[model samples]
Target chain A: METFQHSFPSRPLAWPADRSWALAGVVGSGNLEVLIEPNPAAPDAVAYDLQTSIPGYADSWKAALADFAAHYAVGGTRITLHDQGAAPVVITMRLRQALDLLTPAQP
Target chain B: MSRVPYHELKARERLAAIVDPGSFAEILPPPARVMSPYLPKLGIPVAFDDGLAIGRATIDGKPIYLAAQTGQFVGGSVGEVHSAKLVGLLKAAARDRLPCVLLIESGGVRLHEGSSGEIGIAEAIRAVFACRAAGAPVIAVIGSDIGAYGGMGILSACCDFRVMTEHGRLGISGPIVIEKWMGKAAYDSADRALVWKTSGGKTRYLLGDANALVNDDTAAVRAGIARLLGPASPVTLAAIEARQAELAARLEQFAAVTSPEAIWQARGVTDPAAATLDDAETFVASLAPAAP
Candidate 1:
């Protein structure tokens, strides 16, 4: 298993008032779970704490996370992910899904 | 609109679908970071909820404690953290006099964690009885393809009531373990129909093990759980004695039975062939008055 933490600069996120945290996906073969929570301490960046069962993919994970931070308004959030050999595409989708759960639904 | 099968949903999804909308407040949620310490050293991925999602919730506006195990994660095996969460929830339920509901989907103890899990299950069983003694009900809902096996099966039996679906199964050692030990000729695990007939909801319900059997849909499951709620039936010495007698009689009557079909016939299933095709609703409706 490989463990790492990284923070990327992004715009401040407007979190829902009633929500504290949100989660997506499950930890299993070829899958992962994304847990997103409010991190008021870091208001202009998205922080990540990642643990993956398969090693030697730290570069891929960092690149994908950087892209997610740049594209999404996930600043001021701590995203912790547990991966079980999930592909880069799956990881990005799970991140999006978690953010969706955290944000308030649109009318 | 088509409904999602209760068995096919994940742990959190099951909890959300069954409980009252927006009522689930997780006790030690994923953000709490109470994860398994043993998995990291073993090169295994640790889930945020430790493969078990436990929290406080409501059903039909009545406060209750709820738990759902993730079968996809290590077969929903109970590890140290998972069992501790369960034990804590059950203990809290007893203290608060709130009904505790468990959505069990475990293969057994996490062999990875060794005796720690076994001891954890034992402690959890004690907590279950503590709730029962306090007049706080402990309900087990086994409505998943993984079902409840091993120590979880014993814990389910210890609960006040069980709500099961046709997809649910309840047993000690699963069919695969039996087949692996006793050979295919004795108990073929590959025989899916035989496996279901052996420990499935229909057989358990007919034998009076499972209290209620509903459809596979989440709506039906929620309704089934709601119906079993309210006051818990008191456990007494007389009830235990009667249950023992009933089990003894059942064993003596079917001691020589080999096939599930023969057992069904002996249980007053007049048309065993037709009974095999019957769903839960039809099976219960077709039961003769003297069957029990």
Candidate 2:
């Protein structure tokens, strides 16, 4: 619900040999989706751009993104989120989930 | 309680009827008060609950995730938060590998929110496909007269199956819009019978678009959904090609036909008049493709 944006620095992702992009979440009420795609231009700085309807807590959004970037090695990717009113917890969780799905730490 | 028309029933009531008695455990219940953020901006009163009702329930004792749209609230349209909840529910169904049942009574995307709803629908469609890809069936039940229109119609078509009743109608543009486009002489919106005949459940069923047709009774609708809770029909390249051809043939066959009676006859109703007069049971039995 809060309007926010932040970019965190981490190691570049090990780009998948096959796919181009993957998206999760939907642009619906009280919820937002995250889309991750290969940004060949800047594979070292994972860009996080968020547009939210309920604006106010830009800091909370930044904190969530900072934590997600610090936790995951998603630097080589471009992360775009369309958020409605997701709690900070859900935002972080979805970010992690999308990262895991895209990179799949193990496989 | 049962005397009320299906369309008159609230979203929750519709869900209750289609699922097992006392089996529903609504996730994100109304107490959570997760409602639309855009309605109030447009001076529309927001429902205590979001336009959508979603949760886990059982159909004939088989567990599934159910989603119902509240037509009374904003034509059952999807808004930002509403659509997100829906997407989340479908994803949850995929994660749990459970069947997702949608009681569709929407007029498609909520125009108030503009592109947000449009994008939400596109995302939801992708989520629906994700479930289908994972072998979880997504069933759409269309019994309310509001039926499923606009983008929802195409989404319904993409579902694993659709169940409808005679009162239900499905299409992109509603009769009024069509009438406006073609003028009253070409399509009369006031002619309820003609409207029903064109987009009604019986016609859709006869065209093989509707997988099942039951009475307007909720119990019957529930039973129909129960029958198709497990199978997934992933659209493949070959299947898409076949559907394209079928649709082309349909357009070609109906090109010269202005009235629905002609459509029925073209589809091999020996006596179109009598066939239209027949009840669902007899009409279904009497159906035959026009002799090639």
Candidate 3:
């Protein structure tokens, strides 16, 4: 029922120098999934697009995405989030969690 | 103070109370804080484990993997994190050769998350069968009022056994939905007695869908759990065929009957009112073995 948009800055991801797209999640109630794909159009910025059912927390979402982009080196990827009323805290956590799973920090 | 009684215990508390004391070791604790990726735009409150509590525990010293749905949080619906936790837990049970006990209280897939919960439930079903194929037991407990509906109901049906209480209910679509679909003349949701007769524990027991019917009391539930802990029901092809044949016959027999009470009478349950009032023990003893 609500929609929001934001973009974050980050260094380009370090893949095997090959893969183009990586997606995670399906559309469901009370939850939304994210799909991160490689977008060469804007290598310096990771564009974020979000659509949700439970509206009125755009600022919180922006903060979460902004923080995630700043922390992760996921520049060339465009992250699209589809959510259905998940909490702001959960959104931030899941975005970070997904990124962590995709790109683990070196030991 | 806790607003609810035994039923009020969150998923974890329920698990702890039923399982052997101190035997529950949570797989991924809240400190891990695994949550749903969706919902913030909608402004929903997120639980620590995304509303599902999964862990390893023992009941009557029988090792089992326990997963309980938190109905309070989003109707205990499954989202990505919740579903993944469940899938992972089932996989763990399959790998460990442990029986899996699901304290089902979900309203099916979480609609807020969309198709992710739906697909996750399907995956969980496959996982359940995998465990069954591996000789691991998967027991579904429908003690909560939510019982299981939607995709979760089908998953519960696929389970080896279902244990329920008079307060418990099970069906693919809830009475409200059915009533809406059928209209008040066809099905009345507010008719509590009618609803119970249609899908309540006693009805399910008479129909043979519910393996055991216990009282609302926790002690009775615990006893029922202890009784069924020894064996996991595996759904082999032969068993499925047999069940299909049997269910087909029952449907044929009762499909034409508009009154649930009539079905009860034909099932050899004399005085439907008397039978409904009987406690779990009496109810089980009073009934004749299901007609072939």
Candidate 4:
């Protein structure tokens, strides 16, 4: 497995006072699971810890995550992913889904 | 009205859909990220829940502990953390005197983890008996196509009651293994009908293995679970002896039987073909109540 840690700058993620975490997707062939948890210790960036079965995709992962951070308010949280060769599109969707589930709905 | 097929639902989705709405309180959820420590070393991608999503939940307004296995994850094989969660949940049910439900969808032990998975299944089996002895019914739902196999089949058999569906199967050695061992002429795994008849819910329910057989829909499965939520059968010497004798009698009676059809016919399924085509509700209705 290729495991790595990275952080991207983004707007402060608004979290719910009642919830601790949110999760989306499952770790399977061509799929992955995204786990988002509060990271009060780091309030200005979204930290990522990723482990993928198919290695040599670090650049693509970083680019996708960086784009997600820029597009959404996901700072101040730690997202951990367990992937099994999911495509880039699927990964982006799972990250967004996890973040959406973690944060409360906006007006 | 048609409903979401329970077999198609994932582990967490099964828990959320079957139990009372918003009743699932996960013990060690994904965010906890209690992943497999061994998978990474083997260059295998790990699941945050270790392929078993276990937690507290309510069924029909009655509090119960529930666990759902993710069949997509290495065939929902039981590894260290996965089986440990099962043991912990069953133990908690025993301590609290609450019923425990297992929505099992596994092919057996995770072969990738080796003996760790095997030992874990053994521990989980012990915990199942512990809960049963405590008068806390350990109800298993063998309603997924993956069904219970290997150690899981043994564990499920230990449960106080089992709810199965037409899609579910329960057996130690699945068709492929039997076919490989006995040769194609003896047992053809490619024959889907023969395979299902051999191990599927209908035959098992007819043989008194599965306590309940319902439709594949989540709603039907939920109702099936609700029906078996009452008192558990006491684990006593007399019960064990009687069960053993019954099994022995069944084996002796069907020892020479060549097909599952004959077994079904012997069990009073007058038209095995017609009975096989019947839905879960209709099928059980046409037969005598399964042995206790």
Candidate 5:
């Protein structure tokens, strides 16, 4: 088991006032889950906390999360993930899904 | 016509088949991250839903609470988080006055998590009775090949109704465990026929243990659940007394019987072999009415 915590600088998030949290994915074999919730303390940073069954992939995880933070305006949110050897592509997809669920639909 | 086997369907697929189209809504779906923390410590992968999926759905437009255990994930064992979800769901059913259905397919407690799983199951059992007390029917659907064993088998018995298929086997101890303790001559684990006869749906139904025995099909299982969704059996003192007497009579009447065939014969199954081969409908039709 491996655990890591990192925070990425990001623009302020335009979160909906009604929704507090959102989640995506299932942590099964070759799968992972991402949970996104608001963290008012870190309004200008996106906090990423992860626990993975397969170790030695911290570099890959950091890269993926950095890319997500750079692309998405997920500031003032805490993102936690439980991974089970999911590939890099799946990790990105789950992150995007969680973000999509967190963000309110456009009119 | 060949169809997809019920046991082969995934947890989500089973939910889709058992409930009304597009009515199923998950409570704490996979994304909730309410998973077991013990599995990763033991180098085992943790499932997002902790191997149990609980949600609200409707059957025939009537609301109900439902849960499905994923047998492929950790053999569908109940760990701390898994059993907590079950307890919470049943409690919710009691609070909402809704029927609760469990699509059970577990080998019982998760060995990796040890005592936590056992305690969790005990807590879940208490919640089962709580639902019954609230007049909410708690149903166990044991149709998967994995069946329910160990604490889960006992838990299933505590429910108001049990719906089983021939593929399901319910017992405290599995055949392999019994064989290891009693040697080959006493009980052969490899003998699938003997194993099924000992704890299969047919024997349990004949013994009045299982409430309904249906075919190994999703529609059949859904129908079985639908028939039981009306009202729960009231758990009164008189009802308990009658159940106690019936159980005592069953024990006394079958005390000396060693073979399942003897029980089958006593239940008016003239040809046990033929009855075993019959489908659910034909088998139910062939049974003689119970003596009042």
Candidate 6:
């Protein structure tokens, strides 16, 4: 098992007032889950705390998350990931799904 | 996928088939990422919903809380998080006065997590009774091949009603465990017929352990549940005494019997072979109801 923490600078979040947190995916074989919750203290940073069953992938995880943080307005949220050897595509998809569920859609 | 047998469907698929269209709302859906913290310690894969998918849904426009265990993951075992989810759901059902349905396909507690799983199942059982006391029906659906074993079998017994299919087996000890302890000659696990006769849905129903036996179809299982949705069986002193006497009488009546066929014959099943081969409807119709 491997555990790490990393934070990335990103645009501030446009969180919905009705919701504070959202979760996505399940941690199973070759699958992972992403949980995103509001963090008022870190208004301009997205914190990533991850624990994976498969070790030695910290560099890959950091790269993937950095890319997600750069692309999305996920600032002011704490994202925690529990991974079980999910592919890069699955990880990104779960992150996007969690974020989509967190933010309200435009009418 | 709609043609797929209920016993073959996955946890999510089962939920989709049983609940009303577009009415299912997961309480802590997969997105919640509530993975088990202990699995990683043992170098095992963790499931986001801890191998149990629980949510709220309407059955025939009536509200209910539903839980389905994923047999594909970890043999649908119950761990700390999984059992806690069950307990929470049952308690919520009691508080809300809603029926709770458990689609059980587990081999009971997760041995890896040890005592936590056991304690969680115990807590869930207490919650089951709590729901009963609050006039909320708790239904156990055991239609999968994995069936319910270990503490889960006891938990199923505690529910207000049990809906089982021919593929479902409910017992404390599985055939393999019993064979290991009692030796091959005493109990041959390889003999599927004898094994099923001992603990399968047909045997359980005949023994009065399972309330209803349905076919291996989602529609049949759903219908069985629908029939029992009106009101929960109240747990009164008279009911408890009657149940105790019934169980004791069952033990004494079958004490000298070595084969399931003997019990079937004693129960007025003229041809045990025909009874075993018949489908759920025919099998149920052929049997004599238990004496009051």
The prediction achieving the highest TM-score against the true structure is 1
DockQ score for model 4: 0.76
* TM-score attained by model 5: 0.76
Every model: iRMSD: 0.5, 11.2, 10.4, 0.9, 3.1, 3.3
Q: List the pairs of residues colliding in candidate 1.
A: none
Candidate 3, superposed: residue stretches over 4 Å from native: A1-107, B1-6, B288-292
What does DockQ give for each predicted structure? Answer: 0.88, 0.02, 0.03, 0.76, 0.26, 0.26
lDDT of 3 by residue, A37-93 (tens): 667778888899776666677888888888878877778777767676666666766
Cα lDDT tens digits for candidate 4, B1-292: 6789888888888999999999999998876768788888898888889999899989878999999999988889999999989999989999998999999989899888889999999999898888888888989999888899998999999899999999999999878999899999999998989988999999898889998999889999999999888887789999999999999999999999999999988887889999889999888888755432
- True-vs-predicted CA distance for residue B151, candidate 5, Å: 1.5
Model 1, range B1-292, lDDT digits (tens) per residue?
5777988898988999999998998888887889899999999999988999999989899999989999999999999999999999999999999999999999989989999999999999999999999999999999987999999999999999999988999999999899999999999998988988889988888788998888888888899899888888688999889999999998998888899888777766888778878877778777857546
Assess the local accuracy of residue B174 in candidate 1 as a C-alpha lDDT between 0 and 100. 94
lDDT, candidate 2, at B125: 90
RMSD of each: 1.9, 15.1, 10.6, 2.1, 5.6, 5.4
* Candidate 4: pairs in clash: A1-B43
lDDT of 2 by residue, B28-59 (tens): 76535576788656544455455787999887
For model 4, what is the alpha-carbon lDDT of residue B110?
Answer: 86
List model 3 lDDT by residue over B146-263, tens digit each: 7788888899998888888877788999899998898999999999889889988888888889888877766677677777776677666898898999999998998889998998
Tens digit per residue, CA lDDT, model 6, B252-292: 99999898899878776789998888988888887646411
- Regions more than 4 Å wrong, model 5: A1-107, B1-4, B288-292
lDDT of 4 at B161: 93
Worst 10 residues of 5 chain B by lDDT: B283-292
TM-scores, each model vs. reference: 0.94, 0.70, 0.72, 0.93, 0.76, 0.76
Docking verdict class for candidate 6: acceptable
Rank by DockQ, highest first. 1, 4, 5, 6, 3, 2
Considering every candidate listed, which one attains the maximal lDDT?
A: 1
Report lDDT (Cα) of residue B280, candidate 6.
87
Task: For each candidate, report what fraction of the true interface contacts it reproduces.
Answer: 0.97, 0.00, 0.00, 0.84, 0.41, 0.41
TM-score of 1: 0.94
